[model samples]
Target: MQIYDVCIIGAGPVGLSLAAALQKSKQLNKVLILDSIKKPKFNKQGLPNQRVLSVTQSSREVLQSVGAWDKLEQGRVNPYNRMIIDESNGQDYLEFKNQQAHIIEYDNIVNALLEVYDGEIEFESKLEKIELKPNEYVTVNDKFQCKLLIGSDGNKSKVKECSNIGTYGHSYHQMGIVCTVERTDQDSEVAYQTYLSNGCPLALLPLYNPYSSIVWTAYMDDYKYLMSLSDEEFLKVLNSQLGRYAPRIKSISNKRMAFPLQSLQAQRYIQKRIALIGDAAHSNHPMAGQGMNMGINDAALLANCIIKNSRSGNDIGLEQSLEEYESQAKLMNYTTSIAMELIKNTYENKTISPLRQLGAKIINNLDPIKQIMIQYGSKHPLGPSQFEWVK
Candidate 1:
């Protein structure tokens, strides 16, 4: 019969970050986080984790607000100042020169958030049941009750399922192959993404010196064939495919991993005393590397809403108070999702190859247009930013 002001499900980066943000407010004392799995450990001495996030400037600011940015191991954070985009035909290309994004290990981000968040965490506490008590509160597993129950548990969230929130989106029917590779020339801090003839994009994201991470998006059949190749054979194919676009690969530094790609968005972000964030609410194709960044924004905006409501002596879980969060977050997530889908479809269309190449050249030469696109890709907040609440 323990009651908390907020109970967040899932202990990934997004969940922990929400916990950290809530813990920053003195008015909200009873906050808890529950995760079904044990705490993840980040080995600083080991090879970089296959899973990495491209932290944009906006995401960096959110982490800084919660005091987690400084906790990240600086040595492992690789900031790429430039990004090169082109087609396999090499007819035209686009180059963006400025601080674009940072490639950091997923475990590194989780560990940093854990360090900054000093709230109650229940590990191995799988959610079995959730009972809604109308305007009163929501109870989980008949053990913990909270005025607001936030779901940060990822795409297959139990909280989302129990709340009966329906999601709508289509699968890309593609897989993203991720792995760490050694590069002969690592002095350059640049990210290269080239769309192949088959419309798949292979991105080489710079990591720590001498190493980089690759995210190769391919159709299901091509993915299966690539995964079947030996390490040496795969490297050969990769080098031959990149040609003059990417740095020469010296060796495969980590085991290759693949995951299905899809774009998902919950029907609604809030229901009564329940709310959803992160992958629980929406997930997008990784082509833009904005999935994690979008989730981080969700946690930030939700935490800000909850904090402001609490300070104003308002009910945190009430629909009115949570509505703004839902509206804003959904708008951002939806816009990004649509943009990614359009990019994916446009690149895969063979008839638009000439126009696409011409457009890339035109945009590359237009500084203002290119900057605007970069900001959009970074998910920079616009007009009366919600981040003000964090400060």
Candidate 2:
């Protein structure tokens, strides 16, 4: 009987993140990461690296904790010192800056973490089944048992299914359409977004000085129409309405992508001794692009808690600890989901008033709100103390 201290059952950002996080754990030296894919080429071969993860300060600390931050590429990573969220009407806008928030290349961060943590990342090991033994040990793939099992698999986590954990939340009547565009005229390291009042998409996030990632969260039917447009026409339509604010049009670089915009959180992020992280536990609407960052935070928190418990000689990933993780995961995931809902409702619901938009405008202009938004959105803009996990 060969048992591991910890086993992660996913190779996405969340799973890799956990391996990265638990790499140097004194409590978990023997860890195995299993993924079903023979290789992580599922999206890599097609997607133009369409993702541009917005790394918060806490996320940076998380990467650093896992020995991956310094490995981030020098030039490929673009920093957004400032961001502006404006309405198509140009009347309402929210602005944040480096003193406000920051971001980085999505793939760069993931690959950096992988490069640093040269450990067991079994890409092709698809989890066919998982059974919790009478001893409460999770036996996965009929091969391994662990003191702990982490389902960082993703939104449709097989771990969650096998464990029979109930879920909550709704599939938003929206789809997040993502793409990359080249900027004709450039300015400071900044991002721009134009929120629509009548059920259109939300904002665009900056990827590079000359490029940005478009996260158009809109109705599926509407997005499908846009998707059918020729590349030039798509850029034209994107520019026609959102273009007036743009210096140049965009062309899909990464596999032109679109997925249903839904917010889902597992009813219990943990079951028995197994803990769920990232999309397995929570999938918030990406109106904010905070999903990856949030999962990174979860990895950091779980790692810290386990390490702390080990230092104090407590059971790592025990029932009590897993409960705490679930509680906190629910809170964080729910709070973020609601925030995204607020913005979504404001734009999607036709009954929303211009006064409501004004209220958003007023809120955005406030220094305290601005600071909190920047801090929260950027994951510890205030400093390390506020976000204790970063410490």
Choose the strongest candidate by lDDT.
1
lDDT of 1 by residue, 214-326 (tens): 99998999999999999999999888877366788999887899999888999999988888998999988898898888888888888878888998999998999999889
- In order of appearance, the predictions have TM-scores of 0.97, 0.89
- Model 1 stretches astray by more than 4 angstroms: 383-391
lDDT of 2: 0.70
For all candidates in order, the CA lDDT equals 0.87, 0.70
Error of 1 at 361 (Å): 1.2
Clashing pairs in 1: none
**Residue-level lDDT tens digits of model 2 in 2-67:** 688788988777677777766666456688888886653323323336666667677766677666
